[model samples]
Target: MANPTTPTASVTCSALSYQWPDGTSVFDGLSLSVGRGRVGLVGANGSGKSTLLRLLAGRLRPSQGSVTIGGGLAYLPQNITLDTTPRVDQALGIAERRAALRAIETGDVREEHFETVGDDWDVEERALATLGSLGLGDVELDRTVGRMSGGETVLLCLAALLLERPDVLLLDEPTNNLDLVARRRLCEAVDSWRSGVLIVVSHDRDLLERVDRIAELRSGSVTWYGGGWSAYEEALAIQQEAAGRTLRAAEADVRRQKRELEETQIKVARRQRHNKKMDAQRRAPRIVAGERKRSAQESAGKLRGLHEERLDEARERREEAADAIRDDAEIRVSLPHTAVPAGRTVLSLRELRPRFGRLLRGDLHVHGPERVALVGRNGSGKTTLLRTLTGELEPLSGEARTFVPLRFLPQRLDVLDDELSVAANVARLAPGITDNHIRSQLARFLFKGARAEQPAGTLSGGERFRAALAATMLATPAPQLLMLDEPTNNLDTASVRQLTSALGSYQGALLIASHDLPFLESAGITRWLLLAEELQETTAEEVRDLLEAAAAG
Candidate 1:
């Protein structure tokens, strides 16, 4: 669906068509227009959301179509890598202007310096303001990019974009790498957008809630919803309910039509038999009898054709109604062996300090099937702790131990081999498991039949995540202690729900490190650990309060 075009700023794609080099079509004859407002672009992973953004940003050309923008455009792609040598000012695109202004202040009186400075004499102030808005105010202008955290780099890149003041801005998964604090800053930046067209593609529900409208891209088309995430969900629920009723009605109609057709055939057959008997009893001339039989057969044929056509139309209606309903499958699997006893000690940490991040010392003990949420700010060592627990990284001082079999699903999801099929990856992880059993279990993860045969690298973001998850949980020893680091990073809303559903069936202890509070809460986190200079036990509310207080400061 296309909204009203903005007089000041507009983005429109006309008869868009694109295909991969290997001849797979991603979009065909797709078109959409955006006016001046915040639009949350949502879709399943690999539904062409990123590709569409790239096309709009002029980074990629469509096979056949035209993208017209009313004004300047800026794009922030999903994966960001900034040069380490550049200072914060240079990264923000204002270093040269600042230099020119400084030269003039030193009484250089050079025409070239004045020309470089131009009318933007306050560029440095604006740059600082943008940086401050993105939670980077403490960062000095001359600070090297290498010194900043991963989350800070993302916000820094966004600050640069804001400095451009483009008429149309596109952000693809902007919150993926950000911590809670940086995410809030990004949300504030989105909330402050009052002009131009701001289109952001993200799986972050909190961020999506800040948008003016939602544009759901599905099946190579865009559907517009009036409000934010909650509103869109409500509207979608109503639509699905109506579609279900319509489907039921259409199915009934089809059955009724089929019955009518059968009855008609039966009645016509009986009538023909009775007419033949009557003709024999009348003993009319042979030619007259033959003509009467021919007419009866033709009439029966017409009646059958009419009923058949009605049935066909009813079936068509049923198909259309079914198409209106979404069938996002949920993962459902059971592993009795993974269940930890109530008194079993799952994990123990003793004054452990990881090799990375800011955690100085950590001591924790977990028992049974406890669900723990590892919450902290960026650079606070959430990932470091998970890695240490998994034995991928040795603790600097103390030891981390897991009593039961364990598995770790990192943010990168590098467990799967790129060249192997999904089923093969699972099989490799789970030695001695029958291929039939592996395939059956994979089906529960929504990788049914041929999907399980696809190479790991060929899968989409959501698919890849599911594939990795299946390999992790279905390992031979049955991971009684399952540790995940940022598991919901790039998953769509549906995929996130699926992950939660899958975890619901998991009978093992969970230790998840994530900044997504909603997801953590839904996962039934029994304990929350705040990882900073030390590991502190905290609650979900307390975590939120701390983040908010920090942001306020």
Candidate 2:
């Protein structure tokens, strides 16, 4: 699948800029070049990574400047929907050619049929091979997409994009909804990409680790990191370490300067007091005394000014040093009341069967404060199982019960009301809770003072997520059984860390459904449940091995 001979494909932007109609400036005069190789685009939420991808793909017009691609470009958007009416071959843009080939085989030597086939008489073969490469080999060429699972559709879309044979490929969060198996297939595609400019925007760590370089988009600018995610993190760690040392030195300088200034003031004050005493006691002639006093005053004034100036300069340097340090604030909240005892029976799923998805006759007993990870391939009933446990979707034929207060944060995060203020939404969920108490708790989630009163619709992605999580955790009756479905779906790396920290304070049972293994491990997941036809308890090592096995298969 790889082209060993490196191609000279590239994507370049010159003084590019973009702004929404709401006057939100995403980028201003941004310029960058992505040469042939795999490039991972990473950034915090609202950092304009997606905007840059759209501008490169020509899906969005830059407000100024230009975008230049060395060759053909194909973009795989974050959200994809396929019409069930079209056959697989048609989706791959080879239906007409396949039809023409069939016509020629039947002795219909029409000029148009030959023209359609052209030199690509093996177009169908190529299409099938590409599908097979993406683990969709069993997908029939004539079958509609309606019969396929979501993961299958994603693979189909990727297969179609590969069929185009573009020189530059742009993928925006391609693994967002893909299961473990589909993710492996996509990873293989990236691994085999030896030529052209491939830029992918994803939060998936494994996918990011496969990149040749990482271009971090921050503050409307791109900073390049050689190698992959691990390299980038190592560089950042080294930089932060150096920054910490610099900051400490700057702070020490400020303190020393301040101390010198104070000593100078004291010395000047004592000198003044002595001069005044001598003058008042008539120790010299009046004229001489006045001259001496003026001289002493001027000298003290100069000394004070000199010391003050040094202190000011030291403060400025300290400020600059502090600015160099990143603000990776973690949410530290207390959850003493949410803690459950060791003997508590939190949840029980007896012969559970969701209305849909792959989970069948699921049976599990969650006791005490166990932290469980619900992992499975796409369309494996992970979400269905969560919803069934939440009672949103009734089980088809089994019993589902929760003994303690439970809360579920679904993938969509639709728990918050758009029209109400964040504080108001939390208050609505926590009826009878005092406003003072709610505001105090919200402050722990980083919503202090006026921020708590901001409309839910106006909050940024990270802020909204924190607010939703705050509400879920800080409900009227504290939730002892918390369930999160793909909690880190669109969260940036820093935000993911913040989420993990918040979960650290959670003393109750946690049942998280996610494909992000790193986040699960960070969240202190005590047990791993792989959901398919049945929920199977597995180890983290085996869960990780699933990727390698899937790719090999």
Candidate 3:
């Protein structure tokens, strides 16, 4: 269903349409209204969730139709980059107020200073409280943003937005690069949303679970579901189940109609033969027999027409019922060459300290087809360790060795050459592999025929990921050891599901670094190693328990 109509809607769009200059349409004749509650907007990668949010936030004017807003709106985009030279207060849009207060304390009672400060004397206090609310309590207001971590910068951007107290707030993938603790803090912010219309475009389940309702964007339309992520999922399951039943019934009707049509045709043919025989046997007058034949033919034609119409209607129903099913297709590929022996060592690390991040002295050995998870805070060196293992960054002190063919899919997904087609990129990685063979393997990664020939730069987020994975897996002497760093960082739910399915088809040792515990657990991780000053083994249950305890505390 579309969002409920109400005068309380803080943000609304009517018959909106947006198209790029290149004539690629993102939305067409779409209408939606978001009122005073937390609405979680979600969809597949290219389903226009972000575009819709932008349109509502007034960052992009509608190419056609109208956009209506009840009050001030603030937006936090997916990628936030603040200049490092600016102090926290300056970045928060309160530098002038704070400086004016300082100047007033120094005995300069200028009118402009009072004008800048206004009557809001507690702006500093409010700013600090906002920062602390997002778990940046120690970050001094005078400090430059360069001193902050990436996650802290994200929180800082959010803090600036929250300071506005806008009537409508829009966040797009707010937790894309946050650590576990930062994500929790964001979740808390979401939980405490009571001010105005808070609409978030995110696939973070934790954040999504905090919303009052879910708005799914698909096929240039908005579908609203009450409650949070779990409720929406349950409702979807029911709908799919009902759709399946309807589709089966439609199929059965099509079959029955076809059979009836055949029966009618047979009966008509038999009657025609019988009438012809009667006309011949009786030797009736030519006019009498002709009239009877004409009547019978007309009756047969009407009966045939009726049956054909019924069959056509049944087929149309079948087509519509089929359309109700989802289009999330899974990738299935066999890679027997990727399997590692039970007793073989795939990697060995000793006293390995990378130049980047905080990974201290470490000694670890990975054997067999073990799927190991690297879990830690944002600045805790998960990516550093992965890079160190890949020898992309040399360890500061010791040896990091890989004994098998390896592949690393980084968070940036820079493995593919942007100028080349997906097939060409795969061929570049696997030099000796034939073009047909490369294309054939690419098909299994869900890039079939023309898709495989498409340039990597033109693909959407999920398609680009698939193309990168295809290039990695289809390489010569298949990757026996695979490493993925924050693989699900910005992926939507559907893309995440597709990634899970793709990983299921691989037979290799894995070392994945992510704060997404649910995805890691679903990856069938054989071991969970929390990275800190050292690596410590843990279980999925223990990890969940720790997260729960953290939440409770």
Candidate 4:
């Protein structure tokens, strides 16, 4: 529990508005207030979640409104790129130690406080302790961050934020790259944290469930809902259902009104024609002629007025229906595959070994068509083995063979060019394809129309992943072997589900090196290549037990 005397922080924004230089307005007159406890921020991609976080962190100033953060704040960004040359401990406490050393050297602190600066050992020890609390206990303090896995980097950032212990903690997709175990550890840490307000921006249902309240951002407005993920989902479902009903009703009403208006106009036209015919036949009867003409004109005018009014009503209904449908333009992709027979031996490694100076060594054999998951703690040489198998790096000894054409989707989406448009990237990857063909292929991967024209740099993480897959899968000859390295790093639940379904039905063999247990489970992985202190083939149950043991320690 947090202490009563601990300074409480309140965040408030008034009539905030922000627009990018390209005239894209993200928020308009948005206002929100948050005070103490854990709050979950939920929104679809491009709903201003990141933008709002930047503003709250004071990284960016609001264009039209004021934001007040009542206390010191610490922010953990979604993608944390680290200086790989530095050790884990050094990276974790770099800012803190630098500040302390400056204080001492500049005489800003009294000599009495010098007792706190005995040696660098204390700083490293403190850093390790903080990291350990976040389940990074086994991470070597001297190990370079570059050698660490994506999951490890995410945990390191969390450790840094924990060490900072600011009055307010702002985490933007903190669990994006984390595996199930690491995610659970993070949730536990947040649950146990004291003396600070926590604001988490994430689309993970499980993570959101841990929060005290949920705030949803849609159409540049934030709606606060009390309770956890379940409650928030329930509320959203109800709202969507109501909106759908309203939309259907409006459509029906508009259709009926349009028919009635058309019928009325036809009747008016017929009456005018009849009046004209009657005047031509009886030109000598002036009184009757005048009366009939006056009646016809009056009727025509009334009919026109009614038609206009009905049209206006129908237009208003259409607008209302459009507003009610949230994110109607959401991309849906269909992953089609031609039947490809799996070979008995997809990948084989015999007496394989790899080493990093005197640090690590491994002997392994991996057989294929089997969904073998490489499981281990951070810095446990999972990536090394992967690199060796792919021939990106040579093994210290032994032989590794990939018998089929392999497609590697790296953790970083390294194949994509940020400056290129999504369509252009696809075309560059698959050269002989025509532009129309490329567009059609991209559409299957959910990049459609203007979205396909957008630069890769402007896309969200999920979108980028989809685009990468689109480019890779649409090659002239698709790879028979698919190797994914942390494939679900930054995907939302929906995207993850879609990928899982596609992979589940894929005919090609899969070799996934990931810490995402849920993803592995969903992909129907039964064989496990446990890569901890040693290389061994084990059952899924064995792997789970090992993970539990590691997490317990």
Candidate 5:
């Protein structure tokens, strides 16, 4: 049952308009209202999900309308900006406590009792408790944020938000960097949330399935579907089918109207010719001849006007049909492949060992053409092993070698240059390629036209990944081996399918470290590398048993 007395929050927009500094309108007359409970926000890139979140959080004012959020709200932006030098405990506890004290001094907290308990030690204990609930209990509070992995940092931010206990929580792509275990932890946290409204924006279907309802945003409008991810998908299919039928009907109407206009034109021409012939044959008075000529001109003028009117109507209908079709077009991605033949030995690791502050050990060995998956808990060294293989991190006492040319895509796409435009980045990576070639390559990855010229820093998470792939794969000779770290983290379903298809068809070897179960299953992994206290190789059946055991626990 749902909790009562959670302030029923309502949001509405009337004639709302928003424009960027460059006068590009993002939303015009867009209005939406969300009540209580978990709501998933779905949209394509640049559909203004973030903008709407800000509006609901009262951080951004609408250009022409008022937005009312009637409760205490906490917002988690998609990209969190943190001071990496601060220790985790200071970042979450000490700093927050100091801020709370300052707020009390400034009269921000009206209750005298809150100011009285300003120095209470229980506050820090509560912060620790919240962190534990989010599965970060094992994390060292004294560790710097810079030393943590992307997934760990994101989890810490979520823990901080949960500790605040706001009346509403807005999370944007909260699970993007998390592994399977951490993602499950977040799901559990969201499910257990009570007395608050939660609005989440994500491309994760599994996470969306846990929400109470789904709200789809397309072309600056919100459509609500009662139920979870499956319901949203069904609704989208129905809409696409209806849009297709409308387009077909409009096309047929346009053809019929064009034919009718052509016939009317022919009739008018024949009538003029007949009148002219009759005038030439008749020895009629000047008055009668003048009246006939005037009548003929008047009739021609009215018929021409009517023909143009019909053509205009037909053009409008055709445009409407085109608009509808455009909305339903699926995102398309094309991953370029190189003709590198499979090598005899894909990757070789000898006595590889990675240590964690002298407390933990990870050792492993892997070989060629093996679809190996590394599984472990959140803090384990699964990613560390991959880094060692790529030489990003040196192994403590072992040798790792790849016989073939290798390409690596990191979890965060740090390979991309944020200051450069997308085209420039691609061009820099493939210097031998021409500007036209670079543009064509990026177009396959769905960055075309003006977007191709946009700075890389401005792209969404999915677009950034596409740009990275285009820059990496389109070189003169592509790498024989591909290593991807959580490549599907922020990608939509369509993009993921494209990548999987591309990888499956490539003749070379791939070593992917990901927690995306569906993707791994579809890719047909032949072997698995389980990373617990140490690295162990096993068959697919053994891997499944291990996963089941973990789940049962």
Candidate 6:
């Protein structure tokens, strides 16, 4: 159900139903209304958060419903690409107005220039202000898009949307690959939003914390919660606690009803035996005895039916109670083979210079089972360094060496073959491993039995990440050092927790490149390396300070 009374700048979807061309249904008669405020849309992977955003943005049409918008709208999708040849002013959509202003400044006095400029004479000023708000103030209007980093481009696109000044704005996974500074800038933009319907679909807990409310999309329905992520979590905790209690009570009631039914049956049997004995002892006539037996049988039947009905009702209640509880299973696996000796050298780098990114030269050394967190701004050579270490990319001048077996899981997760099943993919990675062994390990990663047979391409975002991780970690020769790049880019919170749980079992050296500070802290990172012109050893606290200081400057 939706609130039809929402005024201007609101969005309403009525009986919305959407199905993929393959006949996979996403939403069925789903409806919700979003009024003026910041609304954070949160849900599990494959729960239709992105799809719902698309529908609202008018990028996709519903199969059988209506979407009504009370005002103008703009959308910033998860993946963004801009023409590299376009200048900053052109991309921001203010080039024409700027040219018109220039023409008038030159004293051309053209009527066409006046018409194009209209009331938006301050377009360039507003564009510059918007770009500055998104941490792009240093960029010049004449700069080409090709020179900007991927993250900068995303921010630039967002800047374009902001310049539109639409009544409604939709953003999907806006912070996927953004570094800490970029994230902070995006957060500031979200905080400054006012007087419109703002809906963002994202798994970033920090971003969600800035929202006015939360709209959770689950099972094709929207459940509204007041406040941000913390409040929603607190409310859900209370609900689950109550549900657990009800389930336990229902189970006890079922057991009680079963016992009562058994006792009643025993009593009826004894009474029947006694009645026959009494009839025989009294030497009653045959017709009289027959009538008594028939009446007793009828009474026994009614009593049995009553107890059976009670038991049935109790069982039904138990089922309903059980259904109310959520089962978000965790991944639990052990990898003892990955353990390294305390004094053993795991990795070493000497004056290494990757072919791309900002690092000119760097030196590093890893020992034992040290877990290192790679922290830096986007385009700071983190990925390039990892690739060079893995021998996937050639370095310009120095050497990178690993003393033990290692594996790298890139952000793209291209390690998996889409055509293969989860189990088959693991088998492909770990040659000579038995099918039973792979299946058993896959089960620990939460891909049990038939689920392991699902094609890698068909898996959802979270499931695919788990599968890729499993394949990388479960390979033969047992990688003593594991590396991952932006592993939590688009993962939901539950999935992130699952990944952490899985990593807990790996007794190896870990090098993870990520901007997610909370995750890095939770993963027990023993060292933090900042990627800049040089590789500097730092602490988590220092990393946060550096990002904040950089953003402020």
* Candidate 3 local lDDT, 10-119, one digit each (tens): 88789999997778999899888777999999988888888787877778888998888877778999878789999999889999999999999999999999999877
What's the CA error at residue 58 for candidate 4, in Å? 1.6
* lDDT (10s digit) by residue, model 6, range 136-209: 99999989988899899999999988888778889999999999999999999999898589999999988999
**CA error at residue 95 for candidate 3, angstroms:** 0.9
Q: Model 2 Cα displacement at 446 (Å)?
A: 2.3
TM-score for every candidate vs. truth? 0.96, 0.93, 0.95, 0.83, 0.81, 0.95
Off by over 4 Å in 3: 1-9, 284-291, 541-553
Instruction: Superpose all Cα atoms of candidate 2 onto the true structure and report the RMSD in Å to 1 decimal.
Output: 2.6
Candidate 3, residue 240: the lDDT equals: 94
Model 4 ranges off by over 4 Å: 1-4, 81-132, 136-160, 163-165, 277-298, 327-338, 355-372, 501-506, 524-528, 533-545
Query: Model 1: clashing residue pairs?
Result: none
lDDT of each: 0.92, 0.89, 0.88, 0.75, 0.73, 0.93
Clashing pairs in 4: none
Tens digits of lDDT, candidate 4, 42-108: 7766678888999999988878998887777789988777887887757776545655666887877
Q: Per-residue lDDT of 339-374 in model 1, one digit per residue for the tens?
A: 999899999999888999888888899999999999
**Model 4 CA lDDT for position 229:** 92
Candidate order by TM-score, decreasing, is: 1, 6, 3, 2, 4, 5
The local lDDT score (0 to 100) that residue 268 gets in candidate 2 is 90
Top candidate, metric TM-score: 1
